[model samples]
Target: MSELLSVQGLTVTPANNPGKKLVNNVSFTLQSGKTTCIVGESGSGKSLTALSVMGLLATSLNRTSGSIQFQGNEITHLSNDALSRIRGKQIGMIFQEPMTSLNPVLTVGFQIGESLTVHLGLKGDALKAKIAALLEQVGIPPERANAYPDELSGGQRQRVMIAMSIACEPKMLIADEPTTALDVTVQAQILALLDELKTRMNMGMLFITHDFGVVADIADDVLVMFRGEVVEAGSVDEVLFKPQHPYTKALLDCVPDAEGKKQLKPIDYSWLEAA
Candidate 1:
């Protein structure tokens, strides 16, 4: 339960327009072995917040202000080379779409081994063995490691992404809607696998999603974002069962109940103007 990452006063703005903040001042802390879910609709800046922490904001966007501390060390302004050293080894990220994130030409095994080779200096038989082990760990057969990303199913491709992220046994993981593109059953399986891995390795996880159902299944803490600001933050039960913010309540109203007893409603933001 130790503090693994701390982010304070994070702000992201366009390179040309410093005053136009895409992601306004936001703050949160993630502890080891815990999952913190950032729940928001599209364009609410949840992904931007995660990118700022990873130092992966696009060239068009600039992180104007923030203090990103990982394992008590400030990484807000680290150079690309310095951040590269920490990225795969200490902090790993699973992008939303596995197909685009993975290289189609390279074998999945080779791709997985790249991080292990670069970070741990593993090679030859040792590297291959580790790659096989990682594939197995993520529920993919070791033999499939030789196959290309295009050859695998969508679920399998996502599993490959997960395998690659956890291969280095990083202390923290940032997953940006990793299950968004998968089917329902596969989504559940991937979520379960991630939860199991996080607990086993005690890795702190920052999960980004718009689904409250997913949040209920995975989140230890929840942060509800609206237009680049965290409108509500609390434990899973407090936020889900006893939401304090109107935006949170509105968002929850959109989710359909399991027994079809609750009517799904679209979020209405007209109240904001009146407020």
Candidate 2:
């Protein structure tokens, strides 16, 4: 029930426009063992907000105001090394594209072990054992650990990415459209995987996605972002069924209903593939 991370009055500006803020007064709290989803259309600064909390924002941008605290400790001003240590070890990231986030030359085993080596100080047989366990945990075959990224299917590649992210067993997992670029069934499988892992690891997850369908499926709490601000936020039922904001209602109204199509489930969208 404790807050894992809290962002308050957050505002950031790109180097190009010191006067113009891209993220405006955004605030949210991610509690332990719960999933807080930020749903918004493209360019709404959902990912930016996640990056800011993770201390993974690009050097070209600066936090002009507000505070980001993790486990009750302020991180917005932490040294680069301190933040990096926390970024992957205490907080893991699953980017939108697995192909881009993963290594081109390294085998799946190596990428998964990379984090263990860096954060957990694992090596040799211990590292191999851990990597295999991670692969299996994420639903990848043990044999596939030796395979390269390009040689695997989209879903398989994503599994590898997940394995790598959870290698350190971080307290928080920030997934920026993690299911993007997969088939419908694959998306469900991946979501189920995340749900299972979150429960097992007791992790606080900040899932950033444009898909309301996903929000309906997996979110514990929802924040609807628009034009650099949260337009609506509440429990899923409140935000989805009884949306209070016009923008939130508009976004929800855009969700496709497949009641007429027997094969199309309302909550089943192919977010496994990139939109």
lDDT of 2 by residue, 1-275 (tens): 66899999999899788887889999999988899999988998998899898777898998889898899999988988998999789998898899898889999899898879999899999999999899889888898888999999999898888888889999999999988788879999999999899999999999998988899989999999987888888988899999987677767767767662323234323432333
User: Which regions of candidate 1 are displaced past 4 Å?
Assistant: 260-264
Candidate 2, RMSD to the unseen true structure: 5.6
Error of 1 at 176 (Å): 0.1
Candidate 1 lDDT over residue span 1-275, tens digit each: 55899999998999999999888889999999999999999999999999888888899999988899999999977899999899988999998899999999999999999999999999999999999999999999999989999999999999999999999999999999999999989999999999999999999999999999999999999999999999999999999999998899999998868974646677888779878
lDDT of each: 0.94, 0.88
The candidate that wins on TM-score is 1
TM-score of each: 0.97, 0.93
